[model samples]
Target: MTEMLQFDFMRIALVMAVLIGLTAPAVGTFVVQRRLSLLGDGVGHIALTGIGLGLLTGSSPVLGALVVAVLGAVAIEVLRARSRSGADVALALLFYGGLAGGVILTNAQGGGSSLQSYLFGSISSVSASDLYVVAALAVVVLGIVAVFGRELFLLCQDEEVARAAGLPVRFLSVLIAVTAAVTVVIAMRAIGLLLVSALMIVPVAAAQQVTRGFRSTMLLAMGAGVLSAVSGLAASFEYDLPPGPSIVLLALALFLAAAAGGTVVRRRRARRAGEVVPGPAGPGERPRVDAEAEVISG
Candidate 1:
């Protein structure tokens, strides 16, 4: 790690990785609670169009992605809130349309080659200016999470209840969407738009395997995210691998390890209590770790 950090670019990449690590999972906790795992992917696709726009206009791609992504996120949340039956169809349209638009715009600007870095990531290519943009955006995301964390968690747990409790469900929902969009933009330079969602989600999922409450899950996920990001960046530098894939793969590995360890621990507890060990949770089943009882008790 010390050897890798000796260089200027590596130091910048390390900072970018840590920033991305901390911010992505912070918002991701609410996203997972809301069961919108794919929301990040959709926002990322739309952000690509913003990247293309920036390239075409000779402006900052990060700024362009932030604008477009936030707009798209609001639209998504509004549609999701208003049209339960057709939300999936609407999101599909946006996803494909954004991707197509980005491709056309990028090719028009003759930036097809340069787009690869944003799509797949090039951590070593991250510049000082890019680091500043990422840091600013990350702070914005973390600030939103810190301020709205409780309301956001309630909204995710049950939007109707949040509204009944006098919380602005609509506004908070849109806020989460916007926060997620900013996170995507922050991570794009180091992790790439295509895979940024994994960094947001995988750590949260892994943390869920061993945690018993929303707050604990969020904290553990952030730690796991940081570990994955820094370790994966180091590995990529050492082995000449791509940072994005390396980071994502490491998160996945952590998830698998956590899953196995959690299962063993749960079974041992069940045995001690003379209770039956439960089978694996179904897709629709929220794990016992995330049960409302657990969160409330905690």
Candidate 2:
């Protein structure tokens, strides 16, 4: 523990944690809002294939990941346009195909470096160079989101409406796709490619379950993500476990906590309002069921 606090590598890892935690939720808010969460999973895995190709070519893994990540995003859009199965099926195909290709490439080279670390993650090994890349990527992602946030939100809420409002929805969609690719690439060093998508989606998913508005939800999700990243890294150090999976697990735990917390708050409010018992409906009233209870019962 003492070593972690004083060590430079640990500091870099922590910096990465903060950078990713902040921006991922911002991007993820759009992802979740648009119901495109699976894209994160697809792009992250595709990035692994890029890294494998990079290794084979002795190129920068970051660049390789970026190339494939963006390509995967574009491919998804294209596939969505051409197919009835839409984005989910496209995502599935890209994800598994990329993983299989990467594994084949790694195996062909006799598999010296275990790809599991890239799949699961190990933040303890983060270097200053990786931190630099992450910081740059975070800045770029945040900048794009900030400048075009309004349009992005409009598009996300209702693309046809955004188009009617003359918001250039197509351009914004492409911008988001590219930004997501870059974000995945930036995050790969800290969380690895396979599990990095969780960092993007889990916090936002949790926040949406509790928060009322888009802006508040995004902020809360970012906070949740940062907390998860830092605490998970700390726990990994203390337990001598893999950092990436630990961080993702921590984020998952936060999601569960937020859901439980939201439920408790709702019940408390209902009790305070003295609305626990149902009143008889008026003559015209049919029946109404609580959505939560229905989900639970089903």
Which candidate gets the maximum TM-score versus the true structure? 1
lDDT tens digits, residue span 118-163, model 1: 8878877789999998898888889998899889988999988999
lDDT of 2 by residue, 39-154 (tens): 78888878878878877787876778889889988887667556766756666878899988877766665554657666777676577887887888899999998999988999
List candidate 2 stretches off by more than 4 Å: 86-88, 110-112, 268-298
lDDT of 1: 0.91
TM-score result, candidate 2: 0.86
Q: How many clashing pairs per prediction, in order?
A: 0, 0
Q: Provide the overall lDDT of each model, using Cα atoms, as 2-decimal numbers.
A: 0.91, 0.81
Positional deviation of 24 in candidate 1, in angstroms? 0.5
Error of 1 at 59 (Å): 0.6
Q: Which ten residues in a row have the lowest lDDT in candidate 2?
A: 287-296
What TM-score, computed on C-alpha atoms, does each candidate reach? 0.90, 0.86
